[model samples]
Target: MSDYIDQTHLQIYNSNVWAYGNSKWLGYPILKYPCDLFLYQEILHEVQPDIIIECGTFNGGSAMFLCSILELIGKGKVLSIDIDPQPNLPTHERLSYLKASSTSMQALKAAREMITLEDTVLVILDSDHRKHHVLTELNLYYPLVTKGSYLIVEDTNINGHPVSPDFGPGPMEAVEDFLQSNTNFIIDEEKHKFLITFNPKGYLKRIK
Candidate 1:
């Protein structure tokens, strides 16, 4: 297991899997680890959140992928936010797009308006990976995550956790900082069963 871990690190460093530049879901670019996506489906199945607030939309593949899973589950909606809109995003009845800074009040207001007090929400932070930005996002969105749901912070493997040594403090750092004073959420290691996730320690479940 130790040897495999070392080899995985080397592979990630050599191939830059953190970028996921060529990966896609249903033909649309989706820059995320397939392992993490599988874990997401598992969590979605277990938690069954009514709303998913995704902070980064990119090419919208991930949003579509989430909606696909939700469809199979027979419920749920995805609200994907991004600063710059892409050219072609897949349209789905369960998907909504917001073009705005994820940490901006406009984005927060939109998310709040879409979610009712009775809704169980799951939040994903995948935009502006810098520590400060992610931390701000964590503060702003964590409240939306209902008990037993997740507030996923993606790309935690970067910033030298195993790859992209020079990327600087990213999602992992943000999560660490957020956990210091917050007790409502806890890192759910079960999500790491796949062992090849980009989001190390990123699956934070609201436990309070």
Candidate 2:
């Protein structure tokens, strides 16, 4: 019975109506579930990371949202990266834009230089949901997550996690492979309290 209900919810979550409903945030198309946004606020407040590294910058709404939270906390910065530059992206003192592919060596090198060993960091991977791409990103940014901080792998609900059954090996597959050899991080199931998240079991918290 529980499984049946869960499947029904997944179907709704993958429907066009759901997608169209959450297409705006602060005057921009955030393309994110409100539940996920709420979870982010909670995570940010709890972790208070010195920096938030976001791999995919869509219309800049999500980055702007994160920047606002950092401002409220009176600290932290958002480093958002994307292969294509977003025209008219919102400008914020706490936000920095990197117009480069998230998986490129250039971006990784720059990130390494920007972050110090003592800085507390959080990472969000939302670009190139392909299994290989997500796995590469997980490996590259694993070191950036500070102890007790989260590494959020967004959109893991697809590829048969109940959404997009034919999407083919994606974030969920990448996460499964990533956890096999990486013991420093573990999925924090408590984040799933909302029961409707694009990222299922993708809230990894670095324990060491």
Candidate 3:
């Protein structure tokens, strides 16, 4: 359940009970969305940032995927945060975690010290789902991520549409707000099809 965890660890998570062609994670358990692995690899190659900041750590599977890539690269790591600690703790020489409210600047500052100022950093926003909550998270994380890096938001669409049962406010709303105001960020419409979700969200990579 530490840094060495690999693809073999993906077990038959409750959701995948009936699914076939079951891919596995070598060490960690729990299933994740399809884009998790894809985006992790894409970011590693395209952005190749020095520090990766993740807002959520549910089950630690996704973080393990990202951290594993960093380990393979030998120069990057993760500063992961969560309000509740997952029972399956994520470990790797490069992974550092914090158990605190992501909206707090104090917490982000503490995590900030772990990363270099000039090293490109990617911010994966997955902490809270509320519109205001996600918006607050973006405000805090946006400043830290390098200009060319990314601010990845997950679970934007809960049920295929804004009218979906679980749909309310989350990454989608927050990102929408940011885009309307910021001239530097651009939505990678070309990457739209790469997403697999309710309605799916596009990559809003920083261009300025």
Candidate 4:
């Protein structure tokens, strides 16, 4: 675990994630209600976006949690797409699960059909970690996101192994590819770059 996440009291929540779409069992088992929780709450309270698209719904934990925030805010929905929907089952009324490959144009089209808002705010990329795969996913989703909204790409590094690039190429490498053209979406290099001997990439904003 990185020092930042480790020292942040994430361990307080343990791994007991609520099925109420409030949150999930992701992150350290202890820091379940860490900063990420508050951040999501703020996003809900302030941005109040009507649509959220989250790719790579591993266990639906993260997706459900964010959706619950939207639910509490009185509106908004989450279109969480995953190639494999057999992970941890999620409970969310505002969540619409789509089982399809994130890299597929067909799948993207299907996801678009499920959205209720044209000006979507958030796009969380936690799907296939391969560089090419992340790049492909970015190309399609980035354009759909509203300007000033967030585009969070999770697991920038594989666990604690920053040097070990398990992703065929990686989301980090994919960022390099993306910068070739879409430079307007600048990386908050300090925030996104992992500091704990590992590089867990996180991104924000797809458009300017």
Candidate 5:
């Protein structure tokens, strides 16, 4: 088990250092594993969600990617939020940006207003990976995820999914904590079929 974990860690390190550090998703730097990107594509196709709420808007590459998928799906909107302003966010008819912390009450209120009761919402928490912050975000946004959709928590591979062992409690830990009391959501293992992803076990689907 230890040996396998070590090897996986090295692969994750290489993917982060080489692939994510040196690539772009649709002309925008996207610091995400390619496998994870594929997973997102698959999920978007399968869910055909009405709205996607991305908690972190790093460079807006991922938002652009989602918007492109929405275009292909012929509908949907991307509401991306970040604590800091991104000057060069990708332009898209389906994309909206909000510069605010994902867990802030004001931001949450605005997000709720954007979501209609009939909307099938998907949320991605990629900002502030600290356990507390992720937990707060989960509590704040999980409700937006209608039944049969997803609430994805990115970067769970860090802080010892064998990468960044000393990075402290992050997305993975937060997930463990949240799942204890949350029965409506479960880890969708099929989403990890790619075998190499930055968000292992982070694909949570709402079954209720």
Candidate 6:
């Protein structure tokens, strides 16, 4: 019965992911699972981070979503990074778009400049999903996450943790590699309490 439930969950997850490709927020494309988005809100509300460094802004829908939540929280700003310029991105006072590689020094400098010692920070890595690129991003951004905050690695479901089998050494592999040497963070399995998530074993919470 447990195996049957697991199989059913996977089937539903695959279908949801397929439909999620077309998902949008306020008419802007947002490539994220609905369950994860729900979890994001829970995290945002709990952390109340002063800064959210999002390493990927496709059409800016997710950034916009984050901004909306921050507005409700009445504090916080989003620094969304991406290599390509997205013309459709919406204009928001709380959203800053940086056109640079997520792991580039330029990007790092900008992020550092926006953060202060007193601020609580959260990082969301959704940019390059390749193993090396994701690993580099994990290393570069993990330090910015304040104690008790989160470093979310998205799309770990690819490379066959149940979806996109041919994606090849993606975020999941990068996360596993990152954890082997990093002890300050641990996978917060509670984040995925929802049965379906794009980020499997990807929610790393800073303990110290």
Overall lDDT per candidate, in order of appearance? 0.90, 0.89, 0.68, 0.64, 0.87, 0.90
lDDT by residue (139-169, candidate 2, tens digit) is 9999888999999999998987878889999
Task: List model 5 lDDT by residue over 46-111, tens digit each.
Answer: 999998999999789889989988999898999899999567778899999998889888788878
- Candidate 1 off by > 4 Å: 10-21
Model 3: CA > 4 A from native: 1-24, 159-163, 195-199
Worst 10 residues of 6 by lDDT: 12-21
User: How much does candidate 3 score in TM-score?
Assistant: 0.81
Candidate 2 local distance difference test against the native: 0.89
Off by over 4 Å in 6: 1-21
lDDT of 2 at 23: 70
Winning candidate number (TM-score): 1
Residue-wise C-alpha lDDT for candidate 4, range 1-208, written one tens digit per residue: 6555654323322234522445434431211234555555775676677788878776666676787678778888888888886555666778788888887877778767766556556777877878788888888888766776767666555422343433357777776788778865866554433333122345555446
Compose the digit string of candidate 1's lDDT tens values, residues 70-107. Answer: 99999999999999968888999999999999999999
Clashes of 5: 0
For every model shown, what is its TM-score relative to the native structure?
0.94, 0.93, 0.81, 0.72, 0.93, 0.93
Residue pairs that clash (backbone atoms under 3 angstroms), model 6: none
Clashes of 2: 0
Q: After superposition, how far is residue 11 of candidate 5 from its true place, in Å?
A: 3.2
lDDT of 5 at 81: 93
RMSD, one per candidate, in order: 1.7, 1.7, 7.7, 5.7, 1.8, 1.9
